[model samples]
Target: MSTPDAVPVSLAEIARIAGVGRAAVSNWRRRHDSFPIRIGGTDVSPQFSLAEVEQWLRDNGKLTDVGGREFLWPRFEALGSRDESGLAVAEAARRMRSPRTRSSHPGLSDRARDLAIEAAQLGRREGPRETFEFLLQRWLETHVRQLSTTPAQLASLMTRIALAVRLGASEGGLTVLDPACGTGHLPAAAAQEYDGEDLAVLACERDPALAALASARLGFVAEDRELRTEVATADALRADPFAGVRADIALCNPPFNERDWGYEELATDQRWAHGLPPRTEPELAWVQHLVSRLRPGGAAVVVLPPAVASRKAGRRIRGSLLRTGTLRAVVALPPGSAQPHSVSLQLWVLRAAPDNPAAASPGQDALFVDATRFARPGVREPGPDWDALGSFVLSAVETLDRPDSDPPEGTVRVPLLDLLDDEVDVTPGRYTAASAEPSGVELAASWGDLGTLLADLAGHAQHLSKLGFDAGTLQTTATVGDLVKAGALTLRAGQQPAESATPPREGAVPLLTVPDLLMDGKPSGLLCADSAHAVAQEGDVVVAGVVRAYKAWVHEGPPMALGPQLYALRVDPEKLDAHFLAGCLRAPANGRQAGTHASSSSRVDIRRLQVLRLPLDKQAAYAETFRRLRDFETLLTRTDSLGKRLVSDVSDRLAAGGLTV
Candidate 1:
């Protein structure tokens, strides 16, 4: 069936549905008198009636195979704010599922009702829960700018961790509570995981619109599987809708850095059983609130800012939490794992105080896990390595089972007393045994390995020195800009797209970034379908645009998306050798120029860097020599690292009487 006459679509959504760029949609709007006129939205991104736009596209033979859900998504968004769309959908869903119920949704438009019924029919055919999830996913993609929704993968991980904690406690028939559950992802994940089991999911969201959305999502899942779900629209901190109710498991990813989260009004609230939280530390308040909602020995897993583990302002509450045995484990996640993608975050697993407070020891050790490197590369959201993360969760469960067992690498058993020092820093990195000093046997082995590496290094150095080239006379120099003007190379910088842009799904082209160039000179950024900037070709020289330390590397991999803070230099083989250009780009003189330019703002203008002007044959000849020098330098670095380890190992072994000098 055709879209409703009343529903409108934004230009961006129209482009997406038509399998073309937004510019194409704009061109159509301006060039074709038959194109739909604007009905709503701002002048920059005006909306057009869906029926009119679809008719125009069909008339022009530009129509594509857009899905029913895809066609309705923009219309739903055009209804109003996300909350309005959510409410309309929720009412429609309720009516669709229970047609016999009294009609109270007088606000729902006739067009919205028709679209919702069509959407619900599609849902029923595709399995109601899956279809609803698809609609919700599309809605989330559009409102990503408006909502801080958790990534699906992260939500799954959080739910898995909560379940593991529940299993560790030998709990069944799970009752899960998410106090600050935005859109109810955590609770919904729990419902799915515990399918066919008697699971009760409860959640609270301060935003009424978000609460309605969450309620709709959880209600759909509950209806599909006959699970128990309850959601309320109330501030979880100031007016906890589920107060005095204790659950077996409580999961939360509360809002961070909320300076005025009703601190003055709720200062004397009883939920702060441990201690009052400072105005600056709202995460602590969330932790305590979630803890208060857990029954005795009930487990709660909370996503918190990394600073909470070490921030001095919250030190007293941290100490109280550690001393009271409420805090059980602290896990450090990789950067980009949570919102504020640049900052690495922490997950705190807490247990409610036992009924007899005296019986609960005040100094029990807590598990500290350093999974800081566990996230996979992502374009928009940090994609976690599920296998690694799952392994960590399982290992944590096993550790709880065997308290006396030695924790694995990246995991430690740190005493509460140790964490209660001056800093009261519970950062897992501080206490992890992964950084422990090597033993005598390990030291001796390192020494042995160093000797073998030294011999290999000497052989490579000898070979490099033997392939000698003549020291040429002083040559004329030209900046990269001159070479560009002479058709020797084309230099272009990568663009930095907005953070809200949708990341490419898995298996797309990988993106090369500055960090990747600096670390090992590889394309390590998340894959993206459209980079919206210059892409790196295999023969191109990718230079780090941020000149904190000048770096240049030949792009040897397949052509991929290029990220910000990088320059892609495509060389004309007939004019200049790529390797030679890379070598000159890495020269100290160019590095000095980069440093000078970067001194003001750390941004380097690569075009201004100087290079030695030489014939193609001369460039190739010098390139080979420079290549060998690079190999020599690599071996030298390895040799120096090994030598330091060897010396330290020998000294350590001698002190322990395990080896003779």
Candidate 2:
């Protein structure tokens, strides 16, 4: 609800933003009287003014790339209240709007003039549109914690779906609406997706600052791009802006679970045609309001919490929407699609006009696609594979009543009569193949895999017994750095690979990210084969060079582009065994020795890791032992996965009823 820069920043945060160390900031504070004064907090942990520090950094040339994230946008945010900041951005846009268009300019504040100057300089460097984006991107990153923003991925998904439906029925250009267009991500998505089309974007936001940002960003970015953008500074639901105009495609990712979304006052608002939403059911209200703005045959894609699908309070509204066939597909998105990353969000794809539901939708059965399984597992905040997830969802939509007749996986359709039960639970997980029992053949194969895993696991246990031997004389250990210098190994720190497209490009190479290295799965990301980065080859030692947990692997898979937060060690086979080095690196002692941070999230300095000195034959002996242990862990993981699947399949079958022996 508040801006990220609202609170004075600590020295640590200053250093972080400046991409420097705390020591550097401390030195600056001690040496330079020009350094920003401590605005708040104690001497040991003093906080400085964001605006002053940024200005000091620039004046002293401590900062470069003014448009970069190192310095955030519209310094006026740090000068006064959020509204004041909004006014400054608006004033700057107003001044700039004239010069480019030959329109008259207005008198601006000193701060607004500064902002206008910064934007103009950047605009001269990288065009006007790019300057707007650069400014916005930095602002977004700076306020990531403060804003419950509609993520680019979610915005893209919503616009793509809504626009797809609208395109089928509309001609020429289409009008897009985002009633709660926070930071204009939805409108941005629409503009970017259909840049050549004669697009009209209508946006409204509660916060004047956000509204100004939306207007300025749209104006500059959409310049010369045939975009007609209108951003209003008012609560669209409360003010009902553009209520008379029906949008062909409406996309909204409204504020969720708000107790005071005008519930007490807007009780009689005409948008509630389906039914009056309960006080606790604001998502339903958002859906109905967004739906009300849609023209005949128009489509709306709304992002909502999972509870909206089955909440008892909204049952009446849900039932009405279903009955009228206004509600179409209720897609269950993977977690991390939006702000509350932990909650698997839902997308309510709706048709505007209830009078004209798609007639060909057999039995008028509502389609449900459970795409939650596409979330990248083992990630701290797992995001779905958008390309695969979106494509699967879209494909499933195309196959309305034909349940599970194809491959991208989760899909099921339930007759409206079946769905209109006592509970009226329209959760995709409840009806899709995700919750369905696996067939007899699938179960048989699972059982077979589990059996094989167990057999291999049991057979490997004996090798561990022979690993124990009499204690030998104390031997010296060499650091990984020493080994690298001795020509026995080649250690290359990983770099961030380019973001892989969904399904990837034809020639994009497999990129092993830290997540991929930890999960021991095929690389989920991609990199250009021509990119400048080390390719992890088979038999190389791959270490997840991350904070906290210790994880290392022998790269047994095909060559892959090594991504950031990973260390790839290519050892001379005759000098050092790959498996042995990986196993030794996995040791807690090595991780502790290499760790820089004392906190739970500790960094691993691979150069400081120590490995034992041994002959080639002796190294082979240890390598074999380590290899066996790695195999055991792999088998354990696969077996556990199979065991869980078997249990889930069996339970699902029983829960569905009529379980046979």
Candidate 3:
């Protein structure tokens, strides 16, 4: 069963095992590189090791119904009594130990992670739809974090979207559409809750790769033959994939921040009834597009950029839509719900109720939520958190159902009059008054006082500056190698996993990753705990050898440690200003030296770091700047902490039936 690639078995063997032709296997092989590669014997014949082929097949979509034991045992029996399959499995297990393999196939560690995510959806019974939804979610989730969403925020959004489908939307005959379906998670989520003979859904995506992926996921859903759903690959705006067709609901999360939408060409088109959307405002165009595809009274919940709520050009279109009464509720999302970026988002729930008065609720009385402060700590992407947003939206929608009447249980109601009185500001903060202040202002003040009382260690910064001296001349600046020669700093190599003595604790402290340093430099509060061991201590000057990055932080607490892969420069304070040492590390000449000293494998030599040349006083001044910046950041954190505690307290009370949002 072994092939040239390793433990027997080849791509041909896998094609034979799956009863598919070689072309099919080759196509999959070409598309996904992780498809097992054979050991180095080149051949005209497409080859694969049985172990690698089986692993790839299992990972992609082949052995789902079969439990792991069943999947492995049969292959073992089919092979030989000598248990070659066992050896292959063992080899694959060993491959898992490799960092490359681990990074490539993170899914292997916990195949059930998707299932666990689905378990969060309460009212929905687990079924094939749920399984497919979870699978598609995991697949789409792979790139959304990179495309825009943060990993943590993406997880929360997927969970909330799943719960929304399970709780609020009827699954019996649901049909979903996303006009600007990026990677198609919405339709995929719909396919999970309502993919049977009765339910059908379609997703329209413009990006070819995303459209293909959406097609694959939705086709995979309907591929079972019993399901009745499909994802269409096309521009939802220009060409309505579901044109001349009606949907039960048109759920979308369209692209925001787009300046131009092809409006001039579609001016005479029938979708824009309320008003013509300004060229600068594309959101209204999407709004019209979503409404046009929905059946009368059919609900469409779309996520929009904050500008759509109150931007000048957005106002007229928004007003017309409100006057027409299709606009339902506008739920303000916490910032940073999307990652690598932070812009406030709002959920616009519209229905094709051309005659419904609620849509035309007097004078722009849309339900506004001030969810800006509603976020939980820990890996909150770049903006406001929207982890619990769906629940809030669901609650608001339920309240809206009893329009003009008081809400029951967990709902807050504000008249549109009140909203207008607030100058048509759609931010939820415009409606809701500030909640109780921090419970421990006295403690905060005391801490502030303590910060003030801490004796200011006298430094030569003021004196040197007053004398018109260029502070960059303290040390006859040497390269990092020279510093190493002086024994002022050293590089500690990142240990291989096999060489690691300390196993990673689930949540001890963050182990900084290459990505954690994204966005120009390291984000102030980011830390990763994925690794077992880390290096760097208080007052350590560190540089990421792999990332070619540098950062200097005075670890205020012992918890502020860095990855071992990073080089820590322990400078003699009397000899060099640690801040200045960091600045030298950033110097172009020092960078060249460090690059020269870096290992062939890309690891930087710590000894080379100390060779850089820097003036002493300049180092001190830089250190002073770092200190002030850190202190200011600490104060900002305190202010945020107070806000977070306020929201948390309110959510707790609401959950306990003592308060409402």
Candidate 4:
């Protein structure tokens, strides 16, 4: 046992190091008798000795030197047990980050020193702060199953909302605090997004390792931007680390459903200025703690489970929070927006009641935004539409700042008196009213529009059905590859652009994403201009490469950027009709053929897509029929959309007392 200097690595990391697919790594582990033995981890995902794995790769000519981070990752993992790896990495970061104080800090193992030196060198090469951030992110990703790190997008959204609330105050500079800071994501996001140069961040975590990592990360960000940050390791609820330290803004994604959050121990703690939180409702305790830590007129945004809004156990505290005008806004987020991906969470923005002559009112209304439908579509992992979601939040906050301004749709200003009655249910949906129903005249107009759409759909269907096709006369078929080889068409796959690349700020173009194709051949992704992106020109046939349901579309509008997991087929007008090719690619038989290589997601080889090798004139005839069918589909879809809108409008009007039926 050569001291196990190499860190244990997951199969995914091994695949990356060997430049192979995860399937290839599984095959090697199963088939090769001489493969590295599993040293740790569960049987399902065993971790192997990094040194042995590297040696085996080298012996088999599969190894290539990528960088120090790859080599150093395992060593950091080997420093201690899995629980201690975070602290070890944090120690190494602290040492590498400050060269002058490196010798002063004692007790670092010889192995830790060596790893620190390597990290320092890598940092120097790739901008020390950035390198360390990347390493920290990778480490967090490796332990994501065990860690409760906030998702980057959610962190950004929370920080933005907190910033917006803070801007309403008279504070010139901000001191942002996250008492339950898991990995310092909120603090770092705050430092990055806050426009002020005079800023300070304070974060506390119960886990020592996590606290150390957060401290190191925030310290680095602060140093880079000449800001101030402090991180402490302690249970925020039990121990008041930052006692008497009132921050201008506090942002936290507190741990939810924490049963033993020092309830009995901190019963008399002064932080519970509101009614003491019931033990069953620890999120409420966190809310009160955050409010206690805020200066008068300061704001705090905390992520809590949806239960807190209406849970009977915390009704007293909820009412108190509302009556005091401390609870400012509640915004509901869609599922999979953050950790514990199964549940939909809510962002509760709290502000300390201002101590002013005009602020003596006991029951102030709070802004409630129901943004549950703002999630971007995906196969299983739906992401947030960051721009739209953030904009909605900011707009809601702006509406709150103005006393008489009406909140936007999916949002409302619920009176505290109404909220405190009976259920005291502060759920945004409970307060948000649907759009007012249309008038009788408007309903008649909608009906007329629906009838017109139906007529158009019927006409298009009739035209499509009238086209004659002889199925008995078969034509020779060829793969898309064959057609490309003969220069009949060109096939190109879109490459995902760099994450840091900025999109065009103006005249943003729609991005045709795979999810958009799977939904209904619509462009649902953010509209942005990226010069480096691949564009699908008009008349080109676009097809989804990775999918559960096959989708293909013929480009009919101005050129738009093609997203990843999609292929664009440019047809030669003299050789093939674009619509005909699109229809052929979208056929059920072609879908089955493309699904051959697909498992969970389709990995269709676009070149292998088979199409009929008909003559140009015949292809044109088929394309004309396909075009009419496409029009019929368009009309039917539009009609369905209009019908839904009409029904919703009618229902809303009826509910709002604007309509009779």
Candidate 5:
């Protein structure tokens, strides 16, 4: 095999990297003075050395041809197990990428083009392993989304796992193992966690190709210890690579909806101490395999389909485990935790033996953690928090597993009798209490005080309509300027006042500059520049507004200095509802139309806004709707927040391992 790092790139490489014709580089050098030149010259093509060219591209803020295509490099020989740079392979890849040359290879299909691109990327080394990991991660993200999960769900899962490691009951040289290791992710995570320690991980993959790839990647982390490094190509259920071995912890996310999992052969297995798992239900089989492998008093966490928690066939096995007092905790994650499919996952935490052998206080109780409530909106992952749930579960395990300790209060303890009564209903929500009321009771209590406020607003609208103003009802239509008598809406057009126009004055009121108005009619975080020309009288609609697709915020302040793009509308006494008009103009539909008409550039022009047929009444009607919508949104936000907090608090208590489920 060719030395992986000793590979060289040539003129064809330059064409591929730049995504331009070889002649384009020649034309640029011959015609432009900006091009670089090699020290030894004319005979060799004018392509700059790769490193120098890369640096120049970076300096100019230009993308190299291989910029987004970095995924093609590092895996060349390793993936294909080739020693030398296959000239035929390189030539084939080059021809496939070039449309002009592609016609000559009519035999190649669209699939062939994809393979060729992969080949090209596999042969280069633009950065370190971390960069390659990023590329690999993105690829895997796309694959998972295509298969069943979204990039967001994967990210959420990873975040939860990291959080668990950081706060959970894991201790004394942490270790991790994945029985059904796909690409050895669990082991790789373990490798990362135990970077400097002698950590052991055994991964079993049935697919030879995948096993080879995973073994190659993890060998560096595993070092030379066989126990620390095992990537055997065998079925995990039928063949336990580390047969009698155990670890500090085990983490697994097995394939779901599996049926006919070799139940006939493993019926009398020692792992099935709880009860024999039915052949029709493979989920329980995997669960049994994972639980039995745990060391005495060791903890095991596994992701399972929600059905397994209540399935009748698996009920006997699940009930046996619960009755034996080995079942520790169960947490139900929110739906959409695993993207695309939106299936909620339940995490089952089981211990091999009780922590305190002599004194068992409610050891027969299993903690039910309903963490479905604590999910934050932005976490686009498999579900709520696996890591958080794991941490809470481990914490419970620590306290409950101890030789002598009181079962902590607050954690709900469901006795085996209760579980039996419910017919082995292991769902967390089935045992935990419903969420408490929100804390903002005062805000809710004063809602009956809104009638007067509504009357006042209505009276103001009716008074405006009587003054020959069409502001109350959505009937009369008029342009903004038509209704705004020149004196009424004193249009204060913005100006770019000089920096030296005015110095900061002591106790000076802040200005309402263009930057102060956000697309959402909110003020920006920026402080406005001082200007004597800028001023805002009370009741004047300060529109530091812009007409654009992209959103921006204006600065906070009353008499703010406005940028050239700003337009301050000082409302004439009965002509328009200045607040209502500002909101209508800043509406998303209006901004989108304005953006459509603006000149094309790096940024949209926020000044070309035009309201051809809009009237004051329509603006008022819409404004009222917006106000009510905002109130509803606020209520929903509060409700969601309260629900999540309760779930988090409850999950924390249950994870201490003291409560029974």
Candidate 6:
């Protein structure tokens, strides 16, 4: 068995542990003679003893409290498969439950006991809630192939709809149910809706380990509220734990298209009040189960695959649900809503139906909202616009309750009788028109802006074509380190800002980050008034300290605070020009020399960067040329953005009959 100190760490791991860039780590190795010697790997990427690096950090006041779970996670993952890690997390939660208890859980193997002890120590340092959440989140990430979690956006939206219709019940305020609560995100969302009210959560999960985690998650998130949690480990369909307890509000995101959902043995299950769900329609079974658990006047939200709305095997059940007004709205969510991101999923919001058949509303209409239209265009990452999509679906549901209100675009309310045909298809996209034609005024304005952008781009291209470069004018160069020693320039490294500081209100200073520097340093972040970090001046040159991603430019925007992986070079006006120095650093030869290793993505050493030695009058000529190049680059980006938008706009207008040819 290898001890925790015997573990090896790479240079990249050391930087992550210290919460700084690799350049800072390299600087430490050069300055401190007591640094750990390389014990493994090649010269380009060396490995060192974990224990030695940790001691050096403590002696130099760089490390505090084992770096909070970073040290333990590697050892924990080394335990074995994901199930082993999950058991360790469960045992850690048990240890948290009893502060004085240190005994190993009978479920964990002898190999995992050491990891559980390390996790307990972490729990003591950081609060148990935070440490436990971090461990559980990592565990889920590692096991994404076997499990899936509902997005917080979907959870909150479903919870809010339940809250709107939930009536006062059972002196205990409201009872919320999650029939398939994976990690308790849905139930937690419901718990957060009402803090002062007496609450009770009834959750069920097939996996015992996950059931324990869901219970602990709720315990942490519930805080000081009067909350009672009844989480059962058995499958909800096989054995109903809270069958007699009808809930006032409920939300669930169930596993879709499962074949072995007890269709044969439980052929006459009483929960299937609508009809017996077919072998291939497990999502429909979950829907009926959740709906059955609701009180006479209660409501529940369930997420299902799009096929359930129109599957040939489930058409009878779909029609029965529509005829009784049990399924009120079918909302088509955009891709990336759940595991199978290639296909769009549907959210079925179910309301309690009457017991007698005659009491069902005969003339009621069902709302079909096409939220697939809310997917934003030109986004590289796959995910719906949660804020806009959620608002659209929730508002469409709100419109259903008020018959006088007009339905919004991408939404339609059809008569339930029209949907009671032989097919009984309730797909939202089939009934609702997703895209609407744009007005003539909007189309005209877009065309005019596109023409202006194209003209400006052409002008910039012509200006850049006339400038000629002479390679014979090269001069002797001095390293940035040598220039600093001679009092010609000053170099300052940026610090990592707290992530809690997001974009602030008006009057706050913008923070110049590495990404911002790459895109001309236009301040993509913010630093509040109380912050005391150093700010870059107008004439200072900022450079990104990363190889293969080199970017350098003179600061021309408002005075801004510096972010990590960035360096500011403040030059002496008598000796150097900011634009000239930036252009020198931007050269490919200088970038190759500044990089510390052979790898293309190595961190840069600013001291190794070189600048040309020229007279003040001679430098002014080069500075003017560099300034023009910067303008051409900025104009090129603007032109590319406008060109893409015009292409999309023109195609859309042509399809909608707003444009001819």
The whole-model lDDT of each prediction reads: 0.75, 0.75, 0.53, 0.77, 0.52, 0.78
The Cα RMSD in angstroms, rounded to one decimal, for candidate 4 relative to the true structure is 5.2
lDDT of 2 by residue, 1-661 (tens): 2235444777876775665557668999999887877877898998877778778888888764434433435354454544454555454455455455432224345655666666555455555555455555645665677677887777887887776555244556788899998878889888887755678899999876688778887877576588888998788777877889888889988898888888878999889999888989988889999889988878899988898899898888888888877787889999878878889999988876633455334356787888888887654345777888878777876564354455246777777998898878888888876545678898889888888888888899776766666688788899999999999999987775422113458777787666664564557666667767788889999887666546787888777887666788999987888888998888877787788887746668888888999888888888778888878888888888889989988887788687667
Lowest-sum lDDT 10-residue window in model 4: 495-504
Over 436-492, each residue of candidate 3 has an lDDT whose tens digit, in order, gives: 222356546645654543322112333333445467866554656666667765645
Model 2 ranges with Cα > 4 A deviation: 1-77, 100-110, 166-173, 194-198, 354-362, 377-382, 400-408, 433-435, 466-468, 471-547, 556-574, 588-610, 655-661
Cα lDDT over the full model 6: 0.78
**How many times do residue backbones clash in model 2?**
0
> Which structure is stronger by TM-score: 4 or 6?
4
**Candidate 6: minimum summed lDDT over ten consecutive residues — where?**
354-363
- Candidate whose TM-score is highest: 4
- Candidate 5 accuracy as TM-score: 0.55
Q: Can you give the lDDT of residue 251 in candidate 2?
A: 91
Candidate 4 is scored at a TM of: 0.81
Of the two candidates 2 and 4, the one with more favorable TM-score, higher being better, is 4
Compose the digit string of candidate 6's lDDT tens values, residues 557-592.
778778776788899999898899999888877888
Instruction: Identify the runs in model 1 with alpha carbons over 4 angstroms from their true place.
Output: 1-12, 20-53, 92-96, 99-131, 167-172, 262-268, 353-363, 376-380, 433-626, 629-661
Residue 44 in model 6: lDDT = 88
Question: Native-vs-model 3 lDDT?
Answer: 0.53
* Tens-digit per-residue lDDT, 523-596, candidate 1: 55555565456788898998876666467767888877777767899999899898898998887667667554
Select the stronger candidate by TM-score from 5 and 6: 6
